[model samples]
Target chain A: MKAFKESILCAGHGGQGIVSMGKLLAYAGMQAGYQVTFFPSYGAEVRGGTAHSMVRIQYPEAIANPVITHPTVAIIMNKPSLDKFLGRIAPGGVLLYDAAAAEKIPEKTGVTIKKIPCTAIALKLKDKRVANMAALGSLSKIKGLFSLQELIQCLPFIFSGKQDLIEKNTEALRQGFNEV
Target chain B: MTPAKKILITGNEACGEGAVTAGCGFYAGYPITPQNELTAYMSKRMDECGRVFIQSESELAAINMVLGASLTGERAMTTSSSPGISLMQEGISYLAGCQLPAVIVNVMRGGPGLGNIAASQADYFQATKGGGHGDYNMVILAPAGVQEMFECTYEAFDIAERYRNPVMILSDGIIGQMMEPIEVRYPQKSVDPDKSPWALRGCKGRESRSIRSLFLKEGALEEWNRDLQRKFRTMEAKEVRYETYKTGGARLIFVAYGTSARICRAVVDKLRQEGVKAGLFRPVSLWPFPYKKLKGLDKGTTVFFDVEMSAGQMLYDVRLAVADDSRVLFHGRMGGGVPEEADIINIAKKAVKRK
Candidate 1:
């Protein structure tokens, strides 16, 4: 009756590629044979200001509703998002934020908070956009629920004609996998 | 093979699979809340499966793109939520006038303009009663879950082709965002008749067929409306699907559809556990409204509870089906707010207690 799925909230700035990362995780779950639903916000509300995506994943015969009210995982790509979404994560849930951008990691309240230098690492690796990938890599390492292979499977879909970008992004993903 | 056992899925994803399974070769849509998932899912899956997926610039372009793709005789689809679907009404009317067989899915949300991205069934009147400006009707399918999403989608394409009309998969935010196990069956062989008589596939292999909805002659528009009504009447016979729950010895029937119906089913189960005889009537095909099946329930029922996401759109039709003294009632949770089972069960208890 109630849609009780584990929801993931990916929030950040526009250029940070938060929407693509949310879609990648959703598609990864769908590829893994899990029931997955991904919803993204649009227009002036989401871009550059307070962008966020809601992803709900569930097992068979479990939940009913899909809109993510209490995200089990909160991936914050910026400080504003970290401040806005720190209270939205479920208690004891995982909070992964970019240590390079996030100023204060919200009191580390009951949830698991990981402050990784995603931007610093991606920039060092010569690809600034791969911070979201680093966040995804960090998520995989922390949760161990989804696989790196699943994330890799979604690369070609995102980078259709730009094979060069795919190769660089794959390397960025690998560096992220190793960092976190 | 009985088309294999159906799996539970969200309504939007089901519609996407429905399009893919029905041989929809082209999908063009702009990202909007409540419907982005269907397009996002199609983005990856459609390409992998050899279908075209284009993220259009605006909702207007998306519908017009679908109209363009439909002209080529390809199974094409486009999707949006409320505001975006509103932008598409002009194109929808054009498609209807041109007799293009395209499936448009609207995963509804709260609206008048730029409304909060939350689940609401306020678009009921828009979808069922003439979303666009025209004396025309689109075959509307309101899927309750993933199974209905897939099955109704295939059937929607069939109806669109059969009647030479556009079909709308009217769903809400909850149905669009929710997730359940959805097992897609192998698509049935295309046995439905073709729409080539009016389709614009460059007019090859036959006389040039003009696909336009413009008829300026006197009484011609009236004739077209009457002809559309005739097609609707025929659709009423072939379409019109609903599900009955615990109607064997019921005093009150809860009439709902889409995700609201799913919630009503849960409430009905709760009431059944408490020994209350509350039944459920969920319509799968919303256009043909299932007035006959609903009228059949009017004979034995004591009351009718019209539970909806909005203030009451479908209730009008429910009233049309039941008798005058049947104690028709309304309970709505509008503007993207989901109703709890406790509230529905309480309504049932109070309805029975009043009697």
Candidate 2:
């Protein structure tokens, strides 16, 4: 098979589940048959700091470092994450931001900008905590990195013990997908 | 692509899974950054595995606990990062001096006293060069990916038992923290201290075998050193492990190991597409050094580029192994920084320009 390489960076705060978003994407990406690597910041890199995760997916290949220098896609969950990563998106790449939470993002050219109000969508879904899921839905919609069916099927198992929230999260993802 | 039995897990979790797959029965460790997931994984799984897990009060206690268990002939292990590995140095030296079999993993973080939680391979001098004291060698296995972490950790117990010396899985925070999909296949062999003739488990109706490092008599320590050197020599002959890619016709050889090796691989692929004949030589075993692999190069055409995460720790070894000072070029970063593919490609271009 021909080589297909993609890297994504997700940045947000400590309790925002930004890391979980990377995990879910990686899991789904692997199921879609991509060699995936996810690197999460911890300790001094994130303790009382702006945390981020770099997820690299390669078709029929293994990637080194898992440290993405220029991400093909940047998923911003907050203002600081946007400020820190806005310039790092590759030319003609995509930047998805939670418009409900972030301030004005600096002007940029070439990169596609998708301003999804993930928090607003999640709020309408009755849980602002699922903003990450909204963003995840928008990401899959934009990138087509994984199938929606696979992502939906994996949710209950990913949140295996939490039977109560699976349906709500599935709804959040669907609403977020429709928002796109 | 038909996927293998893919299970995505952090590097540290893979290490824990490997330990269990290898049938390790004793785990004692203090939680530290990057490697904490390993301790937590073992903590949860050891009970189910019918093994022992002790979150020791300190790294010293943890390694000593490993030593205590190693004496009974159980496959024992301890996990730690740089600073904690430093704390376990005396125990490491003791493990070596007493010649007890055990596994130690240095999921290395930035160091020189609690530097940061970022990953670094600066401990190359420490892990492969003998951190504690005396003339000792740990069969150091460097795992570049999560799969290697699982397989190397699984194989470590067997190596430790076979050599009657400590085996180390020298990993860094990057690979330790990175999550990847892997296929894990565990071996069926289980380590039992009771099977070893040197085991200290109750000299029941038999002559006791004492294990200690103290030998104050004239030339006794010398004889012990001789014995250790003999084992080192044997390891040099039998334990060397490495992998090479596209080197048969390449003019530039990127010599590296661990995470740096993977980055070099990506660079090599890119350069190969760009019409630059670049190759990669990755050492899987650091202690054995794989010095012979650097030989038989087309001397007139090849230039070796030594890449590392630390500020050129492995460069010295590369130069020594290549035995040609003029051909080795060094580029690296430290304090938990990693070199990207672009950076290495630029370095390679600059190196080519100089000569």
Candidate 3:
């Protein structure tokens, strides 16, 4: 059996919900019986310049490195995120990004880039706030780490009390997954 | 035992759940960055549990409230950040002088002055060397991640109750603000205020006990000091907790606690893959210092690197543990800066070359 270990990064400004993306990944990883770790950049202004969250998931063996200075997957929600993190992705790694938030996609080798208009899809779903859900959906197809169904199953855990966001967020996730 | 559920939460929120599970009956705390979530969680939960939760006007008031609650033999606690904790040192000294059992949490941030709201472990001296003006040592549990934040908060109350002294759950902004999965395994064990013989509970049917720190009578204060010293020695022998990784046959060892330890673990694993033997010694109980296990590093070991987020605070303890036989090297960053793994890896590689 192969050991499962992959580090993912979600980067954007404060309001972009990159931290939520990191958390959703962790919740989904836990449900899949994988050990997980999540950390956000401290001391950064709550709504200030580029903010990022690092998450790592591994099987049984606890996430060894509590902090991921280098990630296997990079999810860029905005241009500032790309500028700061575009160089850190592992070789042959995966990049799931939002074309709506950033358009000047830098050309890089060895890695695969999937550009999904996450914000545009969320706005079309009538809730721009669910852009993070859309981004998570697109990340599902990048490496097929978690089944889209499993990712969908973790939604109720994330937006538990909201009740109302369950429907649109799922729709947004589906749209993002299919677009990739 | 496998936990029934896993919930993603920051260390601060996990500490809140831990305190609630530990039967924290009275919580009086002022809000501070990186630790505000703990106060907020207690504020809502304590009311539902029919306990007293006061958002005191200042940390000074909050700590004194904890002192009051503990005098009645109730399990009480207060959480604060670095600066806020500094303000509560005097009250903490009083708790020690009175021999009151209380729980104090310092979700430490950058220090010295009103430093930036980032992570640092510079307060090790203040925490272990008696932050207040007195000869006292609080049982300090340094949690590396969110899960320990929850479990140790519960255990901290138990230790304080057992030792009849203050227990501190020390964490940094990184640990406090970071989100991770945790399971709250223990439920709160409520303590009745009327149980302790030293408790001031209406003074009915028995001799009245006065909870006072001032002993002006001759030899009275000296006796209390001796008693405290013996208690401290007893705790040191019984309560040193630490974790070791790949230490059985290693060429290098890393002495770190909390977040820095986690980073060092990564570097150790990486170096091991490249055939350089490395290990990590993490002290969970910062007060007892875990010098015994650390002193066992055999002659096979080449060097020890003391890493921290502060300018050589815990490094001093690391040196004392190893006692200067091996070269105890130090590398750290401070004032809200985190120690990157690259710098640590570089430091270790340099030591390997010199060796």
Model 2 chain A worst lDDT window (10 residues): A42-51
DockQ of 3: 0.56
Off by over 4 Å in 3: A42-45, B1-4
| 1 against 2, candidate with superior TM-score | 2
Per-residue lDDT of model 3, residues B148-184, tens digit only: 9998898999899888899998899889887778877
Q: List lDDT for all candidates, in order.
A: 0.78, 0.86, 0.86
Report the poorest 10 consecutive residues by lDDT, candidate 3 chain B: B293-302
Candidate 3 C-alpha error for residue B294, in Å? 1.0
Per-residue C-alpha lDDT of model 2 across residues B53-127, encoded as one tens digit per residue? 999999999999999999888889999999999999999999999999899999988868888888899999988
TM-score for chain A in each prediction: 0.89, 0.90, 0.92
Rank the models by TM-score, top first: 2, 3, 1
lDDT of 3: 0.86
At residue B275, candidate 3 shows an lDDT of: 85
Ranking by lDDT: 2, 3, 1
Best by TM-score: 2
> Which run of 10 residues does model 3 chain A get worst, by summed lDDT?
A41-50
